[model samples]
Target: MADYLLESLGLLLRWLHIVAAIAWIGESFYFVMLDRSLKPAADGDAAIAGEQWSVHGGGFYRKQKLVGAPAQMPADLHWSKWKAYTTWLSGFALLSLLYLSSPQMYLVDPGVNALGSDQAVLAAIALMVLAWLGYDLLCRLCGFREGLLGALVALWVIGLCLACTGLFAGRAAYLLVGAALGTIMAANVFFVIIPGQRRMVAALGRGEAVDPVPGLRGKQRSVHNTYFTLPVVFAMLSVHYATAYAHPHNAWVLILFMAAAALIRQFFVVWHSGKRAWGLLGVGSAILLATFAWLAPTRNATSAVTPNSAVAAPMHATELPAADTAEIQKIMKLHCTACHSAQPSLMASAPKDLRLDEAQQIERHAALIRRQVVDLRIMPPGNITSLSEAERLQIARWADTLAVDPAFK
Candidate 1:
């Protein structure tokens, strides 16, 4: 019952997070496009940097780019901070519900490093805070030089990816990186961008000239947020693809993927101004192709016995004896029941309601077991159950045999 309630809460929070992220990203993209597409006014005004005319939803709108704070402050000013705030809040809630609440099952992998639940949660929190602080400090020190700052930040992220993968499960590490980046983006709005705008508005109200530095700084952070969008989206979506995160060098996979996403974002950013960025697209494609080639899943034989022991040839499905119902039930009990049974001791809930305790239940889930265990090798997540290659083949052969048997129905 507790698990069911948490699942429902997670769903609600995830929905809210997605909706808020969409709104924030849309606003960001629209403004970036507008900024890039702006043209000098026909009748040049000293205070007008540029202007854009557009039609949306059967309504025409004209927007002016002010060279500085407007001479007369508008009575009503719209702010874009709330969308960012809501996204971060909802995302954090989802993270807590899904990961922090069940660290052993979702966040920690004994193969990576044995991290107690409390230690892992504390590390995750520290990662988020430290990432934001490092990024903020880097921008403050060198953000005036765009190219240098970009290079430095990229290095920092790459280092962080390596560190995270070393400490946490691959999927968790990727999500942590995304959460940190998202926090930086939102913090930019809350701590730097919005505050700067408010100060400008205050000066405008007092009939005092606004400092251009704050506006320039805010623009820098806003542009950084745009570059982060594609990478963060990729990180969020990568949870579904276990192959990428389940590899030995999953950190490299993540870093390369994020690099590709950033390059693609750059292509779009430049393309918005009628500029061709084919080079960026080409580089991104090459990175993705290389990643796919390197990470393709293929079964290989590596003897598990001691070096002094005689190594027997690996077994093939054809050489193995026929796997009957009894054999299938035994294998399922040995490998899957700890977490998939009705009264699971290892996990708070039976994942996906995949109970393997009964014969009928195992037969009913035969196809799914084949996919997750035989094909993907992604179940028994983190290989926590110590599922062996021979056992996986046994399950596969059993499922195939069951498919032809009339009793399987």
Candidate 2:
């Protein structure tokens, strides 16, 4: 009963978290698109101040506001909040359960770094805190509304992301960066935004005027959050791919994926904002190419050598059993030759090492396919290629048929 209760709570929490995130991101996107699409009012910048006009969701929604502050408090004025706070709170809980405590498997990558699991988790937390602090300091020093601030923040984030990826497993690094980013977005609300609104409300209650600077700051931070949503979503998913995480140059690949997603987001942002569709189309094209580059697996330095022991080794030539050479060749060609081939006699992606171009190479790494396709369910990631379960089962069965001679096993 206790276990059942815990499981039920977990499911409910996840559902709520997902809904909240959707609301937060959805509002963020709507505001971004609306802000960009807003046009200058014909009546001049009055009726309020520092305002814009837009038509959305089958109606014209005019969001006009005082350049400074309203003269008096209206009986009913809706507050735009809770979305940010709830999103942050829920995301924090999820991260804590998924990564912060599970240092055993999620935080440390023995293959990549020499650090122990405990050391890795500590490093992750420290880095996350540092990233948030550094970004906050940068904002204060540079001025959030300043154009250079955005570019500087992006550059700094990329640097920190690279460092984290190099230090930890690919997924942890990405999540750490995400946590930091999420912190900034939430802080913008809790620290900068809500406080500003409070001040405005207090002024209104006192029948006085509020300042615009705080609103500007809030808007700037809000815009930043909008741009972050798409890329962070993609980064969150990238961790599941062993090709992306365990690859020799995993960090570099992650960087490319982030940049590409950002570009794609920008492309859509421009298109919805009514810019030249071609420019947006070009960005879309670039995103596709970038994704292709990231997924198109290439061999890494560490994967070159096969271990002498079959237990830990990526299968090798000397270890192959007396399986039907012709049948094995046919299976590899039909099932894997599409992506794992160097020349890729079929589709795209040679996918980080393990070329299925030859019979010997296939035999050497048959066990890898078995593990990835059968055991891991990580290959054909996102089911992009739709590899059938039968194919995966066939590979696994063939692998099982291999002779378990002590010398090889």
- Highest lDDT among the candidates is held by which one? 1
Q: Per-candidate TM vs. native?
A: 0.86, 0.70
| Model 1 worst lDDT window (10 residues) | 303-312
Off by over 4 Å in 1: 300-325, 333-378, 382-409
lDDT of 1 at 230: 92
What's the count of clashing pairs in each model shown?
0, 3
Q: What's the lDDT for residue 63 in model 1?
A: 92
- How many steric overlaps does candidate 1 have? 0
Q: Kindly list the per-residue Cα lDDT of model 2 for residues 1-409, writing each as its tens digit.
A: 5434544665676777778878888888876776666655657856444356656789985675455565656788766678778877877777776566556556665545677767877887777677778877877888755678888888877887778877776567777777777777777788877788888788778776667777777777777777777767766666655555544555566666677667777777887677855665576567668756655643222322212111132433334434453566676676667668876643333656668768677667766766665554445432335566555545554565553441322
Report the lDDT tens digits of candidate 1 across residue range 325-398.
67888888988898889887665678778899998898888877876766555567656677776776677667
- In model 2, the worst 10-residue window by lDDT is 304-313
